[model samples]
Target: MLTDVQLRRLTPREKPYKLSDTGGLFIFVQSSGSRLWRMKYRFGGKEKLLSFGTYPEVTLAAAREARDQARVELRAGRDPSLTRRQRQAEAKRVDKQLQHVGEEWMKAQSARWTPRHAEDVRTSLERLAWPDLGHIDLDEITAPMVLETIKKIEARRAKETARRVRQRLSAIFLFGMAHGLGRHDPASVIKGALAPLIKGRQPALIDLEELKHLFHQVELIPAGGIEEPLIVSSFD
Candidate 1:
């Protein structure tokens, strides 16, 4: 067993050397003076080495615990090195997704949406959402940030535009979530926060004088005339 004092006193040499401890665990002293922890084992008749960490950082007890866990895995016929590599790859893939941007999300939708629509979505994010929320990690975006971001559009009296932007942003976040990037769609939290749209009255000739004038104009036109029907339907 290697004590703390002995491990600390072990300095660098011209070549790397391994100080073995029980159960295939050892301290590797490198020529550069770095003390690293390593475990050696055989799996499927082939020897393999698994690095734990450095001295002081990994410590003697931590190295033993890691080695003990590796032993359990070995007993179960599992390769700890392969499992660790798979986990590292998965973490890297997740990090790449999390670091992705709104533009990437927009681009992914290009196959399903028209170019103009995709361009509009990108433009909305760049103009309204990006300044405040785009550069941030997808999981870090909260409902309040989404609400505040849309309020900028609402401030310009673009109620309908604000609604469209919110819908687009929500779709983007949902897409990100499906791809394992985002945690939730913050824009969905403010469903009814924007101003309601005002409906306009239908076109009609309500004035009595306007109705008489329309009849007079129809009479002025020749029978079976296209202009008369067009003018009449324009008021209808």
Candidate 2:
């Protein structure tokens, strides 16, 4: 069922062309004479094409397997082509935001922060935040995603660090909004979404006798330093 043009797409370079058994996938020669696997399909009443990657790198078996999975998705009322396109679009948007914010943040801190502190903030953002959320659009960042990221930091018991990162992220989102890069400020709306800080409970004193004893203990310490009695009574 494969056409000659399609066969020629797989012209000999140093390898033989392999076609899928179902005739929907094939290895074809590219303009550069390199064999490439391509899949043809129809979804949502529209024809679509997908590249299975170049030869050798994608091997015949691997390409067929990938094509099979795509076909399975297509049969299940899904449009794999549209899904792929959306993912690509999202990646492009995220990359743009990351680059823009990174440059702006660098410029804003150069005059105010010391070299070491600047580097620390830059390095932390680049390493921790960039890898996961770098490519996502700042406006598209949801409260759930921000909460999830905060939870990751909280799990390590770095509450202060988590708070600082949240502040930085909020600033980045604000910057993006100011520059007209995005329409919504998702970070600004996460006040109630984050976990609340809990203050430690102080011990309660039941009677005046305990209070007098505490004061006596406190008086026995040095003038400049009240030591253990003060430390104990402070909790009261």
Candidate 3:
């Protein structure tokens, strides 16, 4: 049981010395006066050491909380260190086909969006989502992963950017699915996870700009073509 006062008073010796705490947690005081927190544990017949972090910066209570979390993971039959490493390594592998799917989706969709807006959407995904998720398969990228990426923009207090980026993500997923490149829209699962944008700002589901674009798209359809069947069926 090391108190804060005792922790502050701990002096560096000729070599590293560990001040023990409960549950195999301890602080290693190095000869250079640096204090680091570590936990000793065993799993699958192998002894392991987990590094908590530096003392004071991580804080005693925070280190204990992290240790308890690791214990919970251990109880659940999971290796916390391995899980962390997997998450950290997720971005290193690139899936070129899925990135190509994104580019194809953009090219097909660019006709529906203004040139500037298309660039904006592409840039948002490239800046925030692509680094973490562009490498993952469309169906393999989970909702939690999309939520995590969107939350980064939210964290920066860019409410509008976050909102638009989330929309773009969902549209991309839907586009991929329509083209048989994806099975689901993970972004749609995290719709309300972000902080809500200003209420009643646009104030219409079919706003003027969207309405114009809708009409423009409709006009682009060839007369007496496949669209005539849909419009005729609409009356029936």
Candidate 4:
């Protein structure tokens, strides 16, 4: 067991040192003059060391709390070290999958989109959606996660961009499902979640007399070569 007195009386050394406590826990002093806590345990017939973070920073109580949490995990027949590693591996896999999906989605839409529009779509997805939900398996993505991503865009008052992002994500999920990379398309379930934009009625016009008057006024205006025609056609 480690006592408060022993922990408090501990001094820094030029070289790293270890102070063992009861059970498998140990306090490690690094050459950088910082103290860290760790636990050595046997899991699956192999030894594993789990880091509990730095001392003074983690504190005695916090260290004990972390140790207890690890013990609970062990009791459940789970290896904390393996769990951490698996999570990291899964995150990497998801990142790769998203990159592939994004590329495929861009290619599929390229023919129908203008050059600038295609570039903008790619940029928006890469900058916004890719960072948050990109590391999640397509099948595992929830409605709330999609909503949260849209909320981020909405926060910037980007209504049109948000709508396009949702559409792009839906397409990605559909593509993933087609290739067996995903199960459900949460984006499909939440369609019409955003507010609709209303298109106002067209301007009302008078009879032929008013039209002729407008045309006469237009003819009376002095023209400066093609510039005047270009300006006049812009309003039409």
Go through the candidates in order and give the C-alpha RMSD of each one to the true structure: 18.6, 14.1, 16.4, 14.8
Query: How do the residues 159-236 of candidate 3 rate in per-residue lDDT, one tens digit apiece?
Result: 556666677778778878887778899899998788886544344433333343335446556867754633311100
Quick one: best TM-score, which candidate?
Answer: 1
Supply the global lDDT for candidate 1: 0.74
Model 2 weakest lDDT span, ten residues long: 227-236
Error of 4 at 22 (Å): 51
In model 4, the Cα lDDT at residue 111 comes to: 89
Q: Which residue pairs collide in model 1, if any?
A: none
lDDT of 4 at 31: 80
Model 1 RMSD in Å is 18.6
Tens digit per residue, CA lDDT, model 2, 46-150: 777788788778765687788888888888888877767898997667545754676586677579765654665676677557776777767667888877876
TM-score of predicted structure 2: 0.43
Q: Rate the local accuracy (lDDT) of all candidates.
A: 0.74, 0.65, 0.74, 0.72
How do all models score by TM-score?
0.46, 0.43, 0.44, 0.44
Model 1 C-alpha lDDT per residue in residues 70-167, reported as the tens digit of each score: 99988888999998899999776554342254566666767976564455556656767767876577778788888888887776656555777788
> Residue 135: error of model 1 in Å?
20
User: In candidate 4, what are the lDDT values of residues 1-236, reduced to their tens digit?
Assistant: 78878888888788889998856888998788678899988888999899988877888778878777778789999998877789899765664475577777788878876565566667777887889887677767899889888877766645555666788888888887787777778876666677563345423333332233345446546766535542222110
